[model samples]
Target: MTFEASLAETLRTFQALSSLRPAIDRAGDLVLATLARGGKLLICGNGGSAAEAQHFSTELVGRYQKNRRALPAIALNSDGSLLSCIGNDYGYDDVFARQIAGLARPGDLVVVLTSSGNSANILAALAEAKKLGLDTIAFLGRGGGKAKGLATCELIMPSESGAACQEAHLFLIHHLCERIDAAYAT
Candidate 1:
């Protein structure tokens, strides 16, 4: 495919998901509500998804835009000690769950990203988040996987390609963050 064609395809796929603006808007509202109520946001994923989770958390805890007050956000996969200890003792599936149990409070939001939506560790974390009464969201692809079923709100792109799905997911988070800032703007 030529450069233009490839870019067109990418943009088309993004638009497909973007068309669900109503749902995305609702999810963004819930995120803002959680934060407004003094609840934190926790995110998790694996590999590239892990990086995305950290990126999202950083945007919130620092500022997606300049000069904004820091928001409370945690990327559960960032802490090496907690990840290693949880994996070593309780098993990999429980790594995120253990951290969620320790840090999450009622009304907090947990966002899980997985292209296949079946990542064991992430699903386990969702389970824990539910138990803790936290609002949950999942960025999923490929039939929305198990994470879709478990999350309170899910945004699933139609793309089956992992790279495309992840790229779209990152942009989705960016939009979410942007909406969050708008809703909470002073």
Candidate 2:
């Protein structure tokens, strides 16, 4: 696609996010509430979404715009050794779920990102989180695929283009980072 076309599509996706305010705000609220109670955030994704997860966690654990105490946020996909071990022992679908089981405690939140919302691992992660009595948040696209309604709260990018969905996810990550930084400013 041409630059102008890409820009237009991204604009449309961002515009649609206004209608998603309630859900988006709830997601932000989840993050703030978990942090306020000294709970950590456990995030996971696949491929590009994995990178997005790391970026979001880094923003919270490091900084968004200004100085703030480091927050607890783990990107479950960041550990290659652990992931390969889980995948080898259990299956790729259990990679995130197993980590959630082992690392999560009460008051923790599980956040998963997927443009397609159909990955087996993402689905497993959400289910594991819910089964453990933890609230789950999903950033998804393409009508949330089969993962819709599974999360306690979902931010579904109303678009079919995965690229547009990913772009939207990045924007929301930054937006949430701003809220987190302000809420826990040092």
Candidate 3:
């Protein structure tokens, strides 16, 4: 696709996100509630989605737009050594799940992002989060694939285009960060 075509697709996807407001609000509320109770967020993804996970963590732990108190958030895929260790020792699919098992507490929220909701590691992480009795938010695409209905709240992108889906996820991430900044603004 040409750059213009891609841009048009992205705009269309973003426009459709208005339909997800209630679900997006629920996702934001879960984040706020967890942080309000001194709980952290455990975020994970793969490839570009993994980068967005770290972006989400940094926005929370550092700052989005406000000079507010720092909130706790971990990008489970940010630690290369830990991910490699788990992948080599357990399996690639166990990387995020192992971290959730080892690090998550009762009040923490698990956030997983996936352009295609069929990755085994993401599935494992969601299952682990559920097993631990923790609430979760899943940012998904491609009709939510296998990971649909697996999360406490899901913002399934309204587009089937992979790039458009990811862009939509980032938009929601920024929107959620705005909500966080509002809640924690100094």
Best-fitting candidate, scored by TM-score? 3
lDDT of every predicted structure (CA atoms): 0.86, 0.95, 0.95
Give lDDT tens digits, candidate 2, residues 82-124: 9999999999999999999999999999999999999999999
lDDT of 3: 0.95
Model 3 misplaced regions, further than 4 Å = none
TM-score of each: 0.92, 0.98, 0.98
Error of 2 at 23 (Å): 0.5
Off by over 4 Å in 1: 1-9
Tens digit of lDDT per residue, candidate 1, span 14-125? Answer: 8798676776877898888888899988899999999999999999988786556789999999989988988999899998999899888888899888999998999899
Q: Model 2 TM-score?
A: 0.98
**Model 2 scores what on Cα lDDT?**
0.95
The C-alpha RMSD of each candidate to the native structure, in angstroms, is 1.8, 0.8, 0.7
Candidate 2 local Cα displacement, residue 90, angstroms = 0.5
User: For residues 24-133, could you state the per-residue lDDT of candidate 3 as single tens digits?
Assistant: 99998999999999999999999999999999999988999989988999999999999899999999999999999999999999999998999999999999999999
